[model samples]
Target: MKLSGIFSDGMVLQRNAQVILRGQCSVGGQTVQVVFREVITCTDADPSGNWEVQLEELAPGGPDELVITAGEEKLVLRDVLVGDVWVLAGQSNMELPVRRTLDRLAEEVRGLDLPMIRQFVVPQSYDFHGPRENLDSGAWVPATPEGLLGFSAAGFFFAKKIYERYGVPIGLIQTAVGGTPIEAWISEPTLRRIGGYEATLEQCKDDAYVQSTKQRDEDRNGQWYARLNEADTGLREGWHQAEGEAAGWSEFEVPGSWAGSELESLRGAVWFRKEIDVPVKMTVGEVQLALGTIVDADDTYVNGVLVGNTGYMYPPRRYTVPQGVLKPGKNTLAVRVITTHNTGSFVRDMPYKLKAGGQELDLRGPWKYRVGAVTEALEPQTFFHYMPAGNFNGMIAPLRRFPIAGVLWYQGESNTGQPAGYADRFQAMIQDWRETWGIGEFPVIAVQLANFGPEGEQYTDWAELREEQRKGLAVPRSALATAIDLGEYNDLHPQDKKTLGERLALSARRLAYGETELVASGPMFARMERQGDALRLHFTEVGGGLTTRDGNALQGFSVYGPDGTFVPAQAFIDGDTVVVRQEQLNPPVHVRYAWSNNPAKANLYNREGLAALPFTTEA
Candidate 1:
């Protein structure tokens, strides 16, 4: 007999709730018994060799053992605890680990030990067949200085904060996948009821179609990279070596894109070299190289020795320089960047330096660069894992029997382009998840999309999606965490997950823990009234009353008239309302606040220091 993959040593069962123990016997018609805390439950294995024993409700706190017996076989699980288990779900933002946040929270996280905080990371898997009965692999790991690096940043902080306030052990089930959309996490039945995804799901369900698409993508990309490598002059000439340095390399500014530059249109390999002067004291201890973020892929080398390589873009380029890699004097830093697309550039507004102990060496400014090879832009590949019901089948479905306190959702960037139906779809998915677990109206703490993109861009898709997320609050026992002011304009994966997690914890306090008096949400738009050419907007949840974040004049407000053209409007606080006026917009019909992709000027906040949610009066 063998227990489910989720049941093992160091596992944490839900506290103050009836826990279901499930396993598969070696043969059918066998008696399976589960003994936990001296409470015995027995059941017979069905024809499929599957058996389940539902245990009575358990209280918090444990270092207990769970014993399961099937016929003559016996299994013992050690170091099990009864705690509050929360499912962390969504896309890359939720999947991003604590190690990525160390660049900003290193001092706070270093040497920290919290054994009560544990996590079972669900392996990245997808299946179009049906819901899985068991996870292929998973294990519970407690928070330690070493183990904490792999824990989800948002989930960890949320757990830490919740534990601090409630004094309950926290167990996190990480089921998030990077770059996946909400549709991927919804069940097949849910997707069918939601409709419009039939064609996509049908194509994905076919084994032949899936295999053919994978083969085609592999062939196309394999040939392109192979050809580019063969033609790369840098590799042929050994440009990574100090002795192989060649002349005629053009000078370019660091921390900037290649657009409008000498290598603007190049769509292949490019070699960049920079020389840095290092001190003996700085090279003595641990040394780290921070290249911020790079476009596409990159293989970085220091002193002719490869330090690190990232396959794709989006991840910050942080590499550890070996003790002997940096010398007392001049050291060579070389990077071979591979751009599948023509847009090869170093991202701006990120760290670009090398650090040793407390000393530093700035690797920014000018760098010598040369084109290695040129090729056509690689075609975009399809991700079968993002199809509807795949992740639900492989990642989420197996955990239905496992009880959870609630869910922490931090997605929606992938579906921003089609924001119109997001509200209905999000609500439907929430209901589906609750029904799947047989948990009635469990609290769901959903994060609104953070502010993003260039300031000059006029895209309102993100804003519209935020409104859709707000609409999701119509569901019972749900809360929305606003992240409008927490994002960087240049980076999609923001590093400040601590604040966002704190916001999620606040939501959990009110929605899940029954903290009725707590102000957990930001100011929400309630109603609007038009007075001639100006509009007065009222808001709810104005904890300690509404105010500006920066103590300056209220901004990010706009007015629109019959022409449907929004113009910048002057706004100021009047009692509990915000009055917006645009002289040119006569008989204004609508008003909006923080309606752009990156509404940098949006500073409205409350006394509790939470930014107001983005909204449009037209809704």
Candidate 2:
């Protein structure tokens, strides 16, 4: 008898909901009995040898074993604990690892020894069909140093906070794919119901369409790799022969895009080689080479020894060069960069230096470069492929049988740029998942988008998308965690995940764990009243009172008079309310706080040292 893919030993079931047990049986087998806490439920197998049983709700606390008996065979699931279950879904920032954050990995890992916290990651997949009945493969593992490495960094931290406070076994089911669009995660039926995505889903379903897309991606990938090989060969040949054909080389900055520079908007593979002198003391030990960041992909070699390589552009610029690779003098550093789309070069603000032991080796001088190939048209590479029911079928459907308390989500970055349609799409996804699970008003908590980007640039659709996320809380039994002040401008993946996770747990504590005194959110804009020339803004969850994070004059507050012209306004804290007034305007109609691509130095905060949620009084 073969079991369904999702069934395995040591799996954590959702504690207080209807638990569905299912599997495959041999031919002619009529019945299967599922026993939990001495209760036996019998169900007959279908003609296809598939069987399912929906068990009654179990108590919250458990150290029980589930036994499924069929004829002469018995399968016992061990060490099952049930408390709360959550689904952590998001893009790259949520997927960013703790190890990437500078110097906090060891301490974070040592502190994250929660035995009751477990995580199950859905393998990346895409399907055009309806939801599948089972997952390809996945299992729940305890949250330890070894288990947490590949886990979603934000999700792990969020679960850790919940487990510490709740004292119950927490199950985290992660189903996020990096760089995936929101449409890809939505169910096909929901997309069709939404109407505009019919053609897109139809294209996804057709085998011919998939084949053509795959072919185009393959062709593009092959051409790019070929160009990279050619550049590497050319650099190797030129370096070996001591060639000095540097007359035609153009001068360019070390860490800026070549599109606006001398390279003149060329894409594909380009080879850059620079010669730097390594002191005698530097040659004996391992060296640190900071190439900053290169567009697309880059392979670096020190003295012809391949030292480091990066597959994508978003990772940091630091790379370790092995010891003995650097000679005493005239060490050669060759970098082969391949770009699938757009111009190629080292991105600005990235560090470019080579440090050996304690000495810094400057690598910011002019270098020689040559273009290997140029093509008018390039094929598109599909690193991520969308399939029918890929995630819903493989990841979520398999766990439908397990009873869970609720779901927590930290997604929407990928969907933020598409402001026009994300609200309905996100709401549809939540509804679909809830209906499919057949659970009754299971608690769902979501993390609101944090503040990001530069100051004073308010031409962002992200603000609208955030409003959409807030509106999602209107769904039954749903809550939102506001994180407006926890984000950094230059870095999309913030290292302050600890605070973000704790805040998320606080929301769960208040909404799901029956905690009443917890202030889970910062000040949220409740109402705005016009008082003469000033707009008096009222807020909720003002734990202590209204304050500024910077302890200075209120910044990030802007007011627009009836003329619709916005200007910087003087804002002051008046007890629980904030007053905003600009001298030029006799009447202010609208007010916006931290409204920009990046709200740098914006310091609105609650009395609890938490940043006030970003919002606007305008529609």
Candidate 3:
């Protein structure tokens, strides 16, 4: 007899809920007996080897053992407990591990030791054949001092806060992947009920077609990576040394795009070489070579040796040069930048230096640059992982029978491009999850899309996507955890996961745990009314009246007339409300607050310190 990994030792079963134990056994028919404490349940394995036993509801608190017997075979599970379980689901933000936030959370991870917190991260997989009955592989892990690094930071801190407050063993099922859209998590039936995916579903239903497409994608991606690897000049030629070829190269500035150089509007690799002298006195202690940020991709080298390589753009390049890599003499710093399309160059306003022994060596100046092979832009790889319902079938279907306290979701960035049907799809997904889990009306706390990209941009899909996330509240027992003030302007994976987790825990306290007094959510724009030449906006969840987080005057409020033109407006607090006005509009048709990709300075907040949800009051 073999049960699901979720039923193993050190696992936490849901409290005050019916426990359904399921598994597979020998093909020959045999009765399986499950005994826990005073409760006992039994079921017979079918000819196909499926078996399950519905156990009675259990209360909180347990450090007991579970014994199962099937024919002559028996399995025993130890160190089991009864507590609250929550499903952690979403994209990169939700999948950001604890180690990524270690710089900020290292002390917390080292000190906060609670063995009651556990997690089982589902291995990434996708399937269109149907729901998978078993996960690829996963095992329950306690929050040991060394194991905390493996847990999702958001889920870890969330469970930690809850466990600290309520003293309950917290079990988290991490079902998330990076760069995935919301549609990937919804079931096929749910997507069909909502429509618009008829063609996608048709293609999905074909087993041969699905398998062929997936295989083609894998082969194509493998070839692409292999080609790039071969084309990496830093790996083939030791051009980072002063002895390498550079006499024929031309001098070009280092801190700007190649577009500014003679090689304008070119793609592919551009090799840069800079020779510098380093003293032994400066290379003694901790040393680092900062290459700022590169466009597309880059592979940097020092003194004929490869120092570091960044797979893609966006991450700042900070590579360690090792202890004895730098000698007391002239050294070469070479960088091979690869751009599939558009100009490849170094980004400005970032650190470009070599630091050692508390001394800095500026690396921003003229350097010899030469263009390598140029090629047309590569076609985007097919994302079979983002196909509708495939992720749900492989990642979530196996855990449907496991009872949970609630769900913590952080996604919607990928769906920002097409926000038209997001609201309906989001609501349907929530309903589908609740129905499939066999839990009636479970609470779902969703983290709204955070501010990113250019601040104060007049037009963008981010705000619209946030609106769709908010609309999900139309479904019963759904809440939004606003993060307008916590986003990095350039980073989609915000490192401030502690705040995200805490905010989610607040929602759980109110929506899931029924804590009425807790200030669970930020203020939402309830309604707007015309007050002569001004507009008065009412807000919900204004605990202790409205106040700014920075204690400054209101920011990010705009008034628009019927002409559809908007202008910045002055706002004032009016007893749990905000009144806005502009000199031009005698009767404003709409009022928008914090409605942009990055409302950098938006300061409206409740006295409880939660920021207001971004909204636009319609005409």
Candidate 4:
């Protein structure tokens, strides 16, 4: 009988835990025997030929062999190691590759080669039903340059750190899909147990849901492709030729967005033409054009020759124009930008210039433009329907027989708006995973949401969501890495995944590796005390003493009075406690730290350089 995709010879199982051995056998096979070590256990195969046997917990050290005997066939599984395993799940940032961050991909992989680190990427799939029994396709691959490029950047970095410290094989099971909500990755049963998910599930069940939703998306994609063909056809047929005298076009910045300018809420293809007068003394060999980032996609041409192009947004603008593309006199630089959703400007604060030889050419000016075509508004479509059990069935279910150490997660961005119920949902998901694995309180470390967007005086959902993540530490054997200081205001997907990964490893070292002396987390709010005309906030995990991350004064602390109005409070570090005082309120009723969307000066930290976890004292 053929074995499942997860069942392989050189596999690692969770050490010193209830190991479950499961597989499919031929129909009508009465009995199946599973042998590990010197002990053999026999169990009857089910009617459909499915069989499962739970092996008693064994010691950690292993080079064990598992033999399965069914009917006349004998299958041998060898070279299995016993160590820790973890699951890394999240959205695009967690799914981002190291290759995209640092340009030196080959160098990064060469330094990251570790045989003990193995990763399995769960094939992307979605279903409304509960977890599935098996995934479509996936296998365990060692951490090599070629293999690491496709693995989750955060997960790979975290696993590498842990493997180096613990000297154990690390199995990383990646079950993440980009642009998916938390509800889609969780089980259906788990979602129903939590509120609000029922409404989302109902929306998924609508009869006309798929058709109505995908209509605008289809139109936008179709229009862009059609416009590209039309442009190509025009170029070939001399349609752009002027009858007598062609009016000169002005020059504009090549790579910036056109939304706030002449274009108003327009998406689709737009053509921008710029004329640059080449200096007579300039001996241009190679030219570099920095177009910043186009909203969706862009194809650039210089002197009627194709120079460079980008297929999507998010990539930084740095396209090189080969040495021979420039001319001596007048040069025409044209760009075709295709946008599906949002505005049509190249993102701001990015490089947008051209360089020839050692001389720099500033391309940040006005440019003449014309509309290629007006396409339909691009509507959001749920191409990958997120459903409970869908990910489990396709991504995680097949790995039941394989052993693992624990779980490391860097998610929660998708569920930010529903912060009130995120704690329970996250708890239930963790418990469900633990129950499925039959592992008791396996160490799970998660990265708290980093500070993002503009800082504001008013409360934000992202803050509340981060507080919920902090609340999750109340669950047994769980730790969170605070990344409040590591986020970028403009970029949601920050490029500094290395720090996030290392911080997670720090938690694992303390929790799983028995590093008792190591401080794994920042100071967490423990209890609050009311003093005369002031509120004193205490903290747990006050390693050594409390300190500020920067030399400046502490920020992000807010005090609320009886009326629930929060005002900026004067805060000072008093030993391990934070002293909060507001002249408006004689006695503060509530206190909050790192409460805003992006706290510009939230410098609360421990002596260990770890940023303090965000929290509220309302409860």
Best by lDDT: 1
Q: Which model, 2 or 4, shows the larger lDDT?
A: 4
Better by lDDT, candidate 3 or 2: 3
Weakest lDDT window of 10 consecutive positions for candidate 2: 238-247
- Order of candidate numbers by TM-score, starting with the best: 1, 3, 2, 4
Clashing pairs in 3: none
lDDT of 4 by residue, 1-619 (tens): 5565555655666667777777778765579998888899999988988888887776655567989998986899877666677888777777877665553233555666665677777777665544566655567777775677777778887888877776777777787776665656566666677756576666655647745766766786676677665655334532233221224443355446565666657766677766677764443676777776777788888776777788777766566777666777777777777777777776666566777767766776777766666666565555644554456555665565555667887778877777787777777778877777665677888889888887674657889999888888778889999888888776677767777888999998888888978888889999999998898999988897899877778888899888889889999999889999999886689998988878768998898888899999976
TM-scores of all models? Answer: 0.98, 0.88, 0.90, 0.83
TM-score of 4: 0.83
* Model 2 CA deviation exceeding 4 Å by range: 30-44, 54-79, 102-106, 110-115, 231-253, 274-290, 317-330, 350-372, 377-394
lDDT of each: 0.89, 0.72, 0.83, 0.74
Give each model's clash number: 0, 13, 0, 20
The 10-residue segment with the lowest total lDDT in model 4 = 237-246
